[model samples]
Target chain A: MSTSRERVLARVRAALTDVPADEPVVRPVERPYADSHGMGAALEVLEDRLRDYKALVRRVPADRLAEEVAAALERRGASTVAVPDGIDADWFSRTEAVRRPDSRDRPLELRELDSVDGVVTACAVAIAETGTIVLDGGPDQGRRAITLVPDYHLCVVRADQVVDGVPQGVRRLDPARPLTWISGPSATSDIELNRVEGVHGPRTLEVLLVE
Target chain B: MSATFLGIPPFPEAARAAVNDSRLRHNLRKATHTIRDKRGAVVTELEDDWERLRSEGAAIKSHTLRHLDHYLEQLEASVERAGGHVHWAADAEEANEIVTRLVRATGETDVVKVKSMATQEIELNNALAEAGITAYETDLAELIVQLGDDLPSHILVPAIHLGRAQIRETFLAQMAEWGVPAPEGLTDDPRALAEAARVHLRERFLRTRTAISGANFAVADSGTLVVLESEGNGRMCLTLPETLISVVGIEKIVPTWADLEVFLQTLPRSSTGERMNPYTSTWTGVTPGDGPQEFHLVLLDNGRTDVLADTVGRQALRCIRCSACLNTCPVYERTGGHAYGSVYPGPIGAILTPQLRGMSSEVDEALPYASSLCGACYEVCPVAIDIPEVLVHLREEVAAGSGHLGEKAVMKGAEAVLGSSHALEAAQRAAGAARNLVPRHLPGMAGAWTDTRDLPDVPAESFRQWWNKHEKGQS
Candidate 1:
């Protein structure tokens, strides 16, 4: 009869009871480097690194962003796209593709969305050095299954949302939230030490470096 | 079909048999070295704060273990609240009985499995087999191990002792007897082998109604269980089944989601040398219609409470089963997992198996002496467990009364000679006088050591005699 929140809190308390309350929770330290001239240079470095990991990156002006995204989807020949509730309407309204909201659908509908070519959503935060995008199951990110089921994911992130390192990202995240940190596409290696890509999760990831 | 690691021979006997096989040694050397080098390179890339992260991981585990009783109760209550059942088992028999009953209640004769070492340590597959239920291993390595009818030799790479050609032979000969058959004339190529395995497992993935798993970490706060792996097989097994059962050891609990950050970094890098694992499946209770409709968690003790009772030995429970220590161990490299005579093998096995199952058998007693106390395992252990220190402690325990009769006698005789200055001096004088009579090759019981190595020549004069003739005059 106890609520999920109560259960989680009780466990946390018990696990931490033996340690001193004042003990510092250590966070990873970021290595020092020369500061970028501005957010643009940092964004460029992020884009470069993301490209190095084989993530597709594109830059668009604020006014023409929706049209560019729609065209990108069309180029991939996608008919339907899963859209989070908080995503800007103009992004899909301007496109010819059908938009499916993750909140209103059941498992069957989600499976249907998997057959579609892609899913587009805004990210909570991005790490530049590791080329990781974190989706916290917030309104924009929708359900965890939405991004996970789709073959291709197009995540939108503003330049300011980018952090220099994992430690900085950890500081910004709430521990209670459902967080998914993605570096690149899902991959695995066999016993013979041969690497294979795209077994589960997203096979192809396209990140729109919207400034 | 017994769950015990009983009737297993001593380490030297088992290893002597394995080392003579040139093919097994070649496969083991190649696989272990490749993984070792890749792990070292990736770990060195984060050279700035690697040690700090390792220390943080160890501290978090230590903090959680110190209050495990409290966290475990909280977790049980939470699971109950979520309409999921929780069962506590003290040993392997109790655990197997609980699971067998649960599965029997579900009226299912088959169950899918995630790659879980705790379950393997208890030999759950064999237990289930005796009960007339079939448990399929979904992890590729585990599948290979099960189908080949062989024991796992390495923690991560269970089939490390076999090469690609051997795997092809195993699949071609045995895959049909299990559930699926390999394609006609399957070659020794790695891709062909993987495609064949994929085809073989896909049917079982879609059909199995019940699933069993072991966790990487269990968050007591939310009663959330996490399993991280490189393949999608775990995700499929976790989500598709109607009823899911997880048998996790108590030591796997972490305080909160925040504590997961340290392990997420350390485990992937240390185990597979990857920056991140491909599939990280996290589920809490039933997610309505998203995953398995019914969930049961069997929290296993299985001599863990005994391990936890020992202040120094308790750190062995902090292991995540990453197998980093195994890859880096020199002893494990030459002799392999089969020599350890237990499911848990290598350096971790040397310390853990003896403690979990007491040093009551010849194999268990010899396990402590399996290592050279080289400290390589300690260096690579993510939790910073001083494995060599534990090995030495177990050796002392074995020397007193816990070891085999022959070993205990040998230690006692050695102690009598070395324990006193007069006895040691007198023994040294006797040995020096008998130098001419000493044979180059040892005879009888001592021959095993000389078989692989040359015997050291005893000098005509003892160091004591030489010192007395020269430097003693000055005194």
Candidate 2:
């Protein structure tokens, strides 16, 4: 018997017999859409959009980011926080929560990760238009599971990392690494089509934007 | 008994029953309208760029479909290079056998699932059960459908046909049979219901060794598969499992990684009416210690090649499964999804199902006529699938194929009469002479058409008679 791959490809070829044999394999896609929305105050729009999605956002000076991060953790009363490697240790200096540092070499077990009160990490890039933050499993992001299993997530975003639109954000990322794009706290419209926040992922998302 | 699409009535019969059920109609009306309004608001936010983005999206998909054979080969090669094993299945049976064997090889009996239409289309859960394996649906809506022994009715929310009160009852009664029990005295509040599901599925996500999923998009250049979802259950299944198998339709491919920019913006607003869904996860293949250690991508055809064969019907393959058309369709709003009798329902389904399954069965034959050609589905489609055009095309194919002999004969008789102006004038005079004798409804097979419609009132005389008399008086 011919392999399923060969058979499937044969079927596909036969199905497209109507197409000209000399047609080009790739055609340029027409992109009349704008690359960015050119928002005058992208950070303010980000804050507004994030708030609309039920995500808490705080903007602070670069020097005060650790203070804001510490205060946010304190506000959530997270005594045991999972901190990925490369995150600033100074950010946790004010908070008394025992930090569990996770890395690719020494990753926390699933059960331990689940038991943490929250996870703190840096974002690869942020889209202000959609209020989304992308994580690429960088040194500070550790692994996908660490951020997912916890009930609370505190993501720190530098002002420079924010983009004006989805297209700009997509252009900045490397697909080779696993990426998670989060707009807000996990939500669902599955129940009677009403939007309800707080499902499986972090119920509370606190973003500290350092300008 | 578990709900199955098999042995279901055809569209007209099922739709008649659905239209009369006040409760189902009320639920569907409320759900579709709410999403429709939300989608309008979000799409309007990008008014200047929305049309351009839509056109670009259509162009990209059209180009990809034309060169699907070349892109599929590239996708296969890229995935293999990314440390993932690729399998090809020409149909559902072959796909199921491959998945079942993969699970058994892991020596695991329980596997968790994300909400996947492809899996639902193939009835993978049933096949897994036959192989002595259990599949747990972790998405809240899917879990409800599983627990209540019901079929999914909507593309986005599977249980849209059931109200919150019904959901609470199902959870309270059936949740225990599954892993966890619902809290006592559970109310019908959506938030409370969501909390109960969170507690119920947390343990299973931690324990399941293998996971099943479907991709929203697969990039040929990067070998990456992306899944966009609102709930975090998808995150858990994609992240925590030891072995992961993704069943993807052959048409879900984009040529390059950058092609995601268009869909990433349009899909969320079109489907769930959000700026962006809560979670969008993209992974090329195995990520060693980060995600699943072993990755297997099963590429499925399942009669898609047959859909591609038709020049007119092939546009349905560009669908992103957004459900935007469903929300905007007036006929769908009244009849709900169950009446369509396919895993896919609504306008896209009406055109897609008949092509994929072939117009052999009554259900498939009935689907093409399910629409009223309102054009709302085409207006709202993100990729711009001309749903109404396809409906007409399929309708013509069905009418020309078999049955409908009575209707065909009537059309032939009309054609013979209308072919001659003299014959038409005489027939019109005969109809005018017997105007008072005509009944309110036609008799025989034609009565079915007039059952829900009124025949036009006949004039006292034909246009020719009136015109001739008025001309003589003027002369």
Candidate 3:
């Protein structure tokens, strides 16, 4: 009748009996590596890294944000776009496709997102060294599903949000929020370790950086 | 869906069969070399900082293990506060039962799975099938493994042993039995194979209400579970399901959220050799309107505590399962994972399997000897697990075990002679006099050594006697 939890904890305590009785449980963690891989122009380097992952990267001035987003959508020949509820409305105003706003009360059905051609949202932070963008369910970025179920993800990253590496990016985010770090489109290396783009998540990741 | 690896032979016997399969050897060589080269390149790009990063990774894991019971309790409290249910499983059976029951509670018969080594270690899919629940493997490599009715052969790529042509045949012949059939004219191309898997699992992802996952790391402070993967199959299973069950090992915990920065950098670089893998998703507990509404975490021990009991062997706990060791291992490159006879394979497997499962069975007993003590695994390990040291330590445990009476007797006799210089000298002199009678193949207790190795010709005078006469003296 003994619960497995108690039994497991008992075994663990007995196993670690060799650990000192008087020493502090938590020790200061040593971090010898640099905070970031030092390279000037982190934003420009971020663009290069993103493109290396086969992601389409475009840097547009703040004034042309809507034009750039619409052009990227048009290139994909998207007929409909699923936009997260709190994203910048102006970013998609110039697009000719019908815009479907995510429901506030409930999640959009998988079939509904499956039918859409593209999705666009704002990123919380970008790691320039790895060419990665993180999505924390912000006002612009809805839940995890809106960007996931769609075939294409056109994430918008601002230059000010670019960090030098992972440490800087982690310092700026909240772990309580659901965070998704995406370097490129969904890819698989299961077949002989050869990376092939397009899988369960978005098949194509297009990043638009506004200065 | 419930294929068991019961009655599998010990490591040496299985390896004997594996090494002879030239096609399998070729497949393994190609796959491992490709990943090894890629990992080497990416790791080298970090320049001088790589070694420091590896040391810090090892130190962090060691500190966690020193106070594991404390961190686990903290992790439990954090998880409960986040509106998630926490279950502790002492071993594989207990963990499997907990997960199966959670799924049945949802009243859903179909579940989708991400590629989790912990689930594979516990054989959760088999346990669920026993409870009349079907679990579909959504990872492309895992799907190939399930369809082919075989065990996972590698940690990263489960189907590393199967070439493209073999996979094409598996898809054309087996995909229909699982769900959607392969499209007409499917080729051996990797893209076609990947596309076929994507198509096959898409409908299942949309429909399945329950998901079973295993996490790479769990933060004790935030109750967050992190999963890193190259494909989005993990993301699909993680996001789509209504009920989520994650089975994680107790050792997967790191102290704080910031600790993720180290592993997130090292893992992707060491594992698939990318600067960052395609997707990494971190979620804590349940969100009201997003992803899974209910969450359950089953923390598994499964002889991990027993593993921690040994001072030298406990270093194996530092492993993050990046599989850099496997890719660099010479013995693993030839013999393949099937030789190790456990869910974990390669150098890490040699030490880890025996500790987790104990040295009771022939396979577990043979595992410590599977390695050549090359130290390549240690050099490439992101966490710096000294696999060769653990192998020798486990070999001592096996030698001192109940089954090896002959080996024990030989060691006792060796202790008598080797312990005393006089006894050693007399024995050496006697053998020196009988030098001409020495055989190429030794007999009796010594045959085990001499059958595979030639006995050295004894000199006219032993070292001690020769040294006594000359100034190069042994007093």
Query: Global lDDT of each model?
Result: 0.75, 0.91, 0.88
Please give me the DockQ of candidate 2 compared with the native complex.
0.78
lDDT of 2 by residue, B266-290 (tens): 9999999998999999999788779
Q: What does each candidate score in C-alpha RMSD?
A: 6.2, 3.1, 4.6
Could you give the CAPRI-style class of model 1? incorrect
Top TM-score hit: 2
Considering only chain B, report the TM-score of model 2: 0.91
Q: Higher-DockQ candidate among 1 and 3?
A: 3
Specify the poorest-scoring 10-residue window by lDDT in model 2 chain B: B445-454
Clash numbers, per candidate: 1, 0, 0
Better of 1 and 2 by TM-score: 2
Model 1 misses residue A157 by how many Å?
5.0
Q: Tens-digit lDDT track for model 2 on A1-211?
A: 1399999999999989988999998776556798776655889989988999999999999888777877998899988999888787887767788899998788999999989999999999999999999999998887999999999999999999999999999999999999999999998888999989999999999999889
Model 1 Cα displacement at B289 (Å)? 3.8
> How does model 3 fare in lDDT?
0.88
Write candidate 1's Cα lDDT for A1-211 as tens digits.
2343244334445434445666544324332322211224557766765675566788877677788788789877888888777777877767888887766243435447657778989888887655677776677887666777677888888777888655666557653444566766655554655455554556677887777
TM agreement with the true structure for every prediction: 0.81, 0.94, 0.91
